[model samples]
Target: MKVGLYFGTFNPIHTGHLIIANHMAEYSGLDQIWMVVTPHNPLKKKSTLLEDHHRLQMVFLATEDYPKLKPSDVEFRLPQPNYTVNTLAHLQEKFPTHEFSLIMGEDNLNSLHKWKNYDVLLQNHHIYVYPRISTDKLNPEFENHPKIHMIDAPVVEISSTFIRNGVKEGKNVQPLLPHKVWQYIEHNLFYKK
Candidate 1:
């Protein structure tokens, strides 16, 4: 199967995330879109991110209704602060038959050079880049790269940080999140200081 790995912290999975994932799953050649919940580094325990499992649960709640979108916790078992290349290698070892690709936004594509072992990642896997409301300049090298496919997807600007801040300030951020995910966040009183 052709799978697209969409990595994110997913602190509270929001509607914008679903729109992009669903777009990739339905319009692109990908057979499945896995919202890989990026686990928090144990070394950085005091970080602002929610617990890894909680974020993963939010992803599960958000994606449960979509057949093509699924949640993954592959990073949770890996060593802390793992790189994308390492995850790709591990996934390759775990699922030898499946063709795995990356699903990222335009902003991420611009900073791809800073990633560890990025050369290996570009050579081994394809990248599906979706539009983002980024003011950052694009890297010239990947402008016409064969491994990169620029998807004409909608530009979603809603961010998890925005939702978190809104919730903390007692604003109505419910519309930004998936119904079940919002319920889960509300029930847990997450981000409410």
Candidate 2:
């Protein structure tokens, strides 16, 4: 099976996430799109991140209805400040029969050089990059690279940070989130200050 791994903290999985995953599965020639919930990203701030379990639950709630989209907790057992390279390696070992590809946004591609062992990542795995609005153009070094595939998925500017802020400010965030996810957040009072 060919699986596209879409890694994120998914503090609260939103519609933007589902859209990208669905697009990749339907159009990217992949059998499945796993929304890998990173327990902690090496490059991001941890202060505002929700508990790992809570984030995982939100992902589950958001993705339960989609057969092609799966919620993964692979990074939860891995070390803190989860590095992409290590996770990719471990996943390969754990699921030897399946092929895994990385799914990311254009912004991540621009900053790919900064990731740990990024060279190995590019050389060993396929990458499907979706466009993000207002990000820097794709780096010239990766242009026409055989390993990278640019996907023309719909661009939704909404982000987890925006959702969190809206919830904290008592604004309606229902439109931005999956119905079940919004209900989960409301019942749990996540991000309430």
Q: What is the lDDT of residue 40 in candidate 2?
A: 60
Q: What is the Cα-based lDDT of residue 32 in candidate 2?
A: 98
After superposition, candidate 1 runs with Cα above 4 Å error: none
TM-scores for all predictions: 0.97, 0.95
lDDT of 1 by residue, 9-50 (tens): 987789999999999999999999999999887777655599
Flag regions of model 2 displaced more than 4 Å: 41-46
Candidate 2: C-alpha lDDT: 0.91
Give, for candidate 1, the lowest lDDT window spanning 10 residues. Answer: 39-48
lDDT scores in order: 0.93, 0.91
Pick by lDDT: which candidate is best?
Answer: 1
Please give the lDDT score at residue 56 for candidate 1: 91
